[model samples]
Target: MNYFGLNHKRNNISRDSLLLEIYTMNLPLYDLTLIVPTFNRQSFALRNMRYWSGRDIVMHVMDGTKLGLTPLQLAQLDDNIHYHHMPELSIGERLNEAIDLIETPYVTFLSDDEFFIPSALSSCISQLKADDELVSCMGLSIQFEYKNGNVIGRRFYQSLENYSLLQTDALERMLAHMDPYVMSSMNSVVRSVVWKRSMRLLCIGDLSTFNIGELLFELAVCFQGKTKVISEIMWLRSYENKIIIDHAKTKSFFIWWRSDDKSEDRSKLLSCISSILTKTSNEREMVKSFMLLALNRYVNTYDKIIIGKDFFNDIIVKIWLLIPNNIKNILRLVLKPFIKFNTTNLILLVAKEWSHEGVKTNFIELCEIEKVIQYFYKVEK
Candidate 1:
């Protein structure tokens, strides 16, 4: 392992000893504890578990529900997978619990609605073993949309796959401003020991936090360490109509109205960034500079205006007057019919509209789009 500079502490784990540990536990062991935390979405989780079973992957499915499984699904679960129920935990808490039961050296949290490709785990393991310094590794995640039991999708959701594998130091600098890689507990695999170190940082003063949970864990693991990113798609994430999404999109300014305070969330995020900034002089500037750029994009991409007495309606009305009157009227007319259609139909219509602007090139570009279709077709690993 490349234990340079700050990672010198890991030098105690010599190559021979580490190799012994690996060999004793079956060197380069493919064993992985797939920790999945699920709520009422038992059906989706079950299907996802079944998909992973083809790879002979060990699973630790944690049910964050009080009622346990709906009898039928419980009876249907494969014996190879272990299922446990714990309703008194948040997603992050459940993840911590699941990781505790993992006997393998590596673990990857897989969300119930998300799916993994066949070779995703194998690829991730190879990258990690090849680069002994990598604290963790992640691969590309192409987005897909499903409708009416039929799947349809689009690729390069935000062009994240455009970038290549990043060094831990470089990624930390970037994350100081805005996270380049999306923050999700389920997207990547990490060394069990690294995760255990992170769990300590995640829980502060015996009071566990939730919203910034995964972000904190990622920051801790990547702190002055190495990380790898496989360009190949590994995870398939689905964000249909989740409650977390609803919470994040809140526009209400009533500070007391929220169940959880966001002040902590903002503080934890800033702290993580500030820690990274202190690492290097050049990195400090890069992090702050990129953060500003991301903030601007965030404002532009997600704009909502609220007017008095319109608590329930969309805030898009406020921007309508800014456009030329003729174009505004034209949009209103065109959008009315589109709004009447179902979300899937509307997405297809919009996708067709944007298809002309797509930058189609060679196999790589085609591969990108095909990957999206693969996710929809359950081909993603």
Candidate 2:
């Protein structure tokens, strides 16, 4: 650790700073780096960068803007942030450049318009250091919208309180659920080494597709080990319909399905599925449950099929053949009803009746129940 702005290692540290140090250990021990990739949100970029100036951090803005900074403004920010102006680059290229320049052991990206919580970095870094197996940590996302002059704050995931990554064996049960875990790029903090490896995987896929980076990233990191959830709303994800892609948030799913990329994507995904299945003692049941979750999400929205039905069905059958008869019967009873429901109703059912407990506990609870009729029936219109 650099020990740049911190007190002696043995001294009692303040709670906030202790949290900061905990978050810091996972990264390389120098000052942290915040990579902001901006297209035209100059003002937002400036404001967000200013918030981190005095902290033990450096801000690098990959400006994809045509306008150059004046000598006066550049000199003023010289002490705070490094401005890399390149109006010609795409978002992906700009991000890649930022990735190359980061010298910190930890690297995280924030949008020009999105604001992070004051202690977000500290919390995530702290959690990472405390758990050696935790490859990455992400804060919860809360959406606060200003519509018709009203400000409404809608919280998505809870703040990470006691949640940390479990062993790989435990992760198998977690990933089988419908909403396994969310990978929010905005609020996630990763070890420098893991980030680099995941980035290499992302680069293999087309950057233009929505979530192409995220999808590949989640698969790579999850395969290595468990990822912890902090549950804090470190990020405020703004609503942008155009930016939301089918699989990820990109131009088209075809970008992931292009002839040259298909085999690679398919192989990577299947490998992930196979690895996940291999670790489980109840492989067939787990596979069926995974399929039920996938089909539920797909039938809820045709978009889920973008990965291709053949690919999807193949995995389902493989899982089915591997699972025990008892497990398959249980999943069918649990998921078959919502299999044909419309998206709106399906979502309502999930919110109303789905398990409030985390994935692991919920799955265990399912086994104890003689029948889940109380949780499944009587859906509100």
Candidate 3:
């Protein structure tokens, strides 16, 4: 009923910004705040800021670089943005720092290079408003990158559709979220109260593996409430892992767990997890069992090989890419019933392969997809 970003009508909107208001549904301006953390990537920071400037949204950008953004750089953003320069902090520390400043009922993270469909976000906000037990809600996420000047992506989660964790017991909810171990649920729109606690442990724990902190976030939040994946397409993630590599270069999995270097942080992290788990199960052994569950799963999953790295069979995908679009569609139809491609088996894939009902036409003409693809096309790796 309301136009997004127009809740407080402007006196005189610029012609350019006026044209960029394409979001159809109204998103409650006060209900959610998107946290974006960036480090050393200037183009990424600017690219992200420019895109969101046009759309009316509340965002808190945490810059970890030693140098603060210049005046001209800050000029590009809008009043909706609250920029903070937090120097000399790890990504985890920056996030841990941002949690306390959140005043919104719902909180979610958007990376400097990622994009979100407005309607998908609105639908998720609606879901959270209706469900008391649901701690988080997001739509199916697809990871994409520019391949030969075209947008290419793949499903980010295995069988991600209609996924829900509504188990009354916190322990049950946490187990289901971890057993399959989807990439990262940290980006999903979550309640501030739950996400804050998760971030507290995540930052203090600072496993750097991303798996433990991420899975622990799942367990910690699910320890509080439920989570869901809606029908709408939510996030368009960048497939580039430069940011991942750069951040993890200093600490590999072994160093974080076995080496004496991370001893104090790791101890603090485990102790926090134990302290939190004790709230659910009073027995020391039970708390230890759950801590072991979180610890055992990620003693070393992606030290040398980042977990984001695909362990799947991609030869078929390579050959699939070599074929023409018509032939690819025909082959996909033929292969549809025979095999299912999951998060494990699929890596960076052609976006056209996963086209939905109305998507067969103008597949690249998706919501903000073209803009994002254009940004990726121009930016350096």
Candidate 4:
């Protein structure tokens, strides 16, 4: 197994063994651990198990689904795999619990349907190990969906290709993170200390509403130190709409923002971030301002993807609802040209070169991960 685990710096090793160690050290092995909190998605879980079983990295698969794998089924997995069947816990709770179990110095999260490129992950780990200031590091991420028997893919967070949170001050880091909040670093390879602290507060402070939990995580990471997004492809995102929507059953962001206790959630979020920032009352106000800035910027940016959440609440929406289903389809086709900005536009067609998951393409960079993306998009079989 290629073990990229660092810290073998003893003065006793021979040159040849040390060279092999150097070769092995290029891969992220025991130094990094993946926290996969899956809920009611055993197929994805099993696919994940199959993918990671051969790797040398440690994976804590905390399955929150009612049905978990049998003992016989678990026996097939590698010893590096640790499975926890916590059917009763929520995702946040599971994350909170899982963080404590991480023995590795570095940690990162993966959605049930997502996959990380091992080489890119190694790159992230290398950056983290090299730089004490970097609390989080990741490569580019691309979203993929199946169509016409091909794995169609595109870069969703291209802005992040050059993004890095290198601000020295905590509040400055927070402010800089909000301006173009293209994606979350929660999934990025983070130092275990930051990951645990952020996740603990994320759970206890109840920052789950109004995307507050997300803000808490990003803030906590950047609050500690720097965050880097490299040029390599890091995440393979599954944009299967049915699978994506199935997981988004929580209160919609608009509904939660409009809720009566929004302020309470906000204050709780403040406390969560403050736990990491540990700033004065006036500085805490700065964090609050940052949260508002992030919320407004985030809402304005992604509200178009809300589908009907904001518009359905409007009284004029009844006029939109009155249109016949057939007529609505025709209108959508007619207005498609005018509707320049929407979620559908992001779902562009991926080409044949991109379909080769294991091989390197001119654009898409997920390589050496043979047949991994096909786990979710099984159009081949």
Candidate 5:
């Protein structure tokens, strides 16, 4: 089946016939290019790329590893696969570099440790072909936590039904629920034109924040045309064995707000948002509501991770003092899920939830769960 859960036979047959015709004329099937950015993970990247090399798709590897792909490793790649070695660069810079080289009509980003379901790619390409106005498409992703080459836990992320947003207020709706829409790059495919245009707004020299740039670019693409979400699981993200608390501790929240170098760039990023909002025919009230909602969600999500507790406390105090009581109540309701009594309580809550699910404790059991996912997604080794 395709990413939209449609039977593959219909779509595959047509695509196959077209490919045969192209091959008869000695042409290339370069409708979509998969951009894989790697950093110090040659083995994982090579293994992941090998699976995709078998497919009739273009695979671009932006290798930023310390010790780059060896001659033997380069020889192993298929002809459709292209590799570019560069000195270490930030993820955003690496992505921009890869974007420059995309010759296909559509481009999708994948990390060294991720792989897409072949059927999912085919489905996305078919959808883009059918709709000229569609700028972006995405589906659910299955994430796995592994240790010592063994899967330790699994969770499903970003499950949204097959729905398209083509109205004037599409950007507002997307920003209002940015948590689900602004997902990992692995879960999305975008028209090359849309991607390039969006990047131009974010790529403002070294001031560009990586995480925020990605979110803004995704929003920009959706604002340009129609955006669709498919419910099926189309990507697998592998993570090292790290608990939520550990991950949170290591994460720097709102880098643009905390970093001296990035704090000034925040205005430029906001201006880009304002530009897109102005172009769309959304009302002022709708824009204000969505921007506030998005900001509240963003603040609540990173409250605990922001550089210093004192800074977060000051921000909360300012919010309480400046905002009217009615608005404060509304904000509280919106941020209820993220509101916490204390750090201990939040940690306990997380631990309780994690253990309540009967967390997998054995490698064999983890492998069994992986098998089920592979079977459901029709993934072949």
Candidate 6:
């Protein structure tokens, strides 16, 4: 058994007591609900959920796939696991549905291909229960590339490595710093009340606008209360070729902005910003900072191809007009290397390397890929 110890100062319960509770299964140590939303990935979901089936936590599986697990199969897992089949609903709707059934005070979302470290979840629960002011908490996720049921490479996702609090002015500073990977459902745990309120504020839109909705909810949580960022890498994310290919193709600025469907999504994001800004003076400034960060994210998606082209007719250009010259200069300086050189093509090269499975790989190559992943979040910090 791999037992991990928590910092004694963070929790009132002793390590021996917690371990005894976990081993004896006679008492519940925390109030946490782990939600796994699965769609057409039964094998992946089942493989990952099996690890948690014997645990004391409440694990809810919202299955929306064409061929999901049967009740018999679910029963085989454990009594602690709850299975809900809602095949007609989308991922976002399934998540909302699962949220409605949560009886725990703290809730966390897990994807079919993500796994949590046992000690990390317990540590986060301890921290959240220790601090009533904290609305959410998360740790870094380590991403692994897999092919033919074999792990090819591993790297940490864009994540921080130090314990930090995002409250008061720190919230604005973190949002302004704008780490796009910082706010993912797979890597976060939030208070149920905060999650409920934030979800209610999300705009009803097409599934393509799901990311926008999630971002708004995360921001609302951060704005409403403090957020604890744990530096430990406590989650494992499985990366497949289809995801990389789709991301490479869809993340292009021209492709994302030129789509007719995205126009409505953009408008909805702006509307969300408007609604959030109406709350308080500090929140208004924070929302404005988030808007600038969002713009920078969109601009950063522009690779070498679109960076040189004139986007005079683009709606995003109007947004660029709203940013102050100082920030605009900073963005330009940040993106200049990619725009002027062939550095942006490194993504394609990495993708190509992954295409050749089981090829001889080195630590340096993996580190290069890690750098590319971190580039999205690197700012003048």
- The model with the greatest TM-score is 3
Tens digits of per-residue lDDT for model 6, 276-325? 44567676565656654645553454443264455544767889899999
Error of model 5, residue 80, in angstroms: 0.8
**Cα displacement (Å) at residue 230, model 2:** 1.9
User: Each model's TM-score?
Assistant: 0.56, 0.55, 0.71, 0.69, 0.59, 0.60
- Location of the lowest summed lDDT over 10 successive residues in candidate 2: 361-370
Against the correct fold, how does model 6 do in TM-score?
Answer: 0.60
Q: What lDDT is obtained when candidate 4 is compared to the true structure?
A: 0.67
Tens-digit lDDT string for candidate 2 (228-308): 765443565443213534644543553444456476664455444444334564763554344334424423344444447
lDDT of candidate 3 over 161-205, digit per residue (tens): 667888997666656665555543577888888888777767754
Q: How many backbone clashes does candidate 5 have?
A: 0
TM-score, candidate 4, is 0.69
Cα RMSD of all models vs. native, in order, equals 14.6, 16.3, 8.3, 10.5, 13.3, 14.1
Provide the clash count, candidate 6.
0
* Residue pairs with backbone atoms closer than 3 Å in model 3 (clashes): none
Stretches off by above 4 angstroms in model 1 are 1-29, 70-72, 156-159, 162-186, 199-210, 241-243, 246-381
Model 3 regions more than 4 Å off: 1-23, 54-56, 209-211, 241-269, 276-289, 293-337, 340-365, 375-381
- Tell how far residue 377 is off in model 2, in angstroms: 48
Better of 1 and 2 by TM-score: 1
Instruction: Identify the superior model by TM-score, candidate 4 or candidate 6.
Output: 4
Q: Which scores better on lDDT, 3 or 6?
A: 3
Tens digit of per-residue lDDT, candidate 1, span 99-125: 568788777877777665535566677
Give the clash count for each candidate.
Answer: 3, 19, 0, 1, 0, 0
